[model samples]
Target: MPYGEAMLTIARELVDKIVAHGRADHPDEACGVIAGPVGSDRPERFIPMENAERSPTFYRFDSMEQFRVWREMDDRDEEPVVIYHSHTATEAYPSRTDVSYASEPNAHYVLVSTASEDDVEFRSYRIVEGVITEEPVKIVEAYG
Candidate 1:
């Protein structure tokens, strides 16, 4: 945690959705983005994305879909606040490949682990230039 407080404050509904997506895509990695107002750093819109690789150990967003989503965000004056993926058999932490592919310096990288159905681990991190810093997540009923 930064400043001894939560670094990621997200809506409970959105949290539920992310966890559900992870659970539904069990045995395979799930990937998605939550777009927010530009420079807001608030993750507001949930956009579930298809994993182009469709592999349990790795994930890659469908390029065409990524293009469309980015265009839509541009039109809406939004940026990716959160870039999230699932870990089917591992913990909610960035893998080496994830660290290599993380390019959004301003976005929070969220990881959801579906390794245990009853205990779905949802963690947030900041991955900048290969440095990974774990942050605390605060799930609220809604953004106030």
Candidate 2:
């Protein structure tokens, strides 16, 4: 996906994994990264991270764990294609804090809302320079 007209093309399995993580975390926010080949917009690796805050409304990745994950991704020559977090009670939208912490301009910011037991809302956005632009998500069985 391009910059202006961005789209998050992810796998169904990855989506399921994210949803499961969100559900398992319950009232707390869950966060993770989907890594892929650097420059390849496809998400291939699911790297769930611990939410250091452990709060229902806010999420902050565990710093030490994040360091290790980044090192592993560097060794694998991968980049965070999607940075995801769950909202326990709110809609699948980025919070002000989330937007302020948007460090990966090229990564898709995916939000999964686990507010309802019956349904889940998954959304993707491009947060660049503090401006968030919601994008379309296309979940496929797998990448070619």
User: Which is the leading candidate under lDDT?
Assistant: 2
lDDT tens readout by residue for model 2, 36-56: 998888889999999999898
Estimate candidate 1's alpha-carbon lDDT, on a 0 to 1 scale.
0.91
User: lDDT per model, in order?
Assistant: 0.91, 0.91
Model 1 quality (TM-score): 0.95
Clashes of 1: 0
lDDT of 1 by residue, 59-106 (tens): 999999999999999999999988999999999999999999999888
| Per-prediction tally of clashes | 0, 0
**What TM-score would every model get versus the actual structure?**
0.95, 0.95
- CA lDDT of 101 in candidate 1? 98
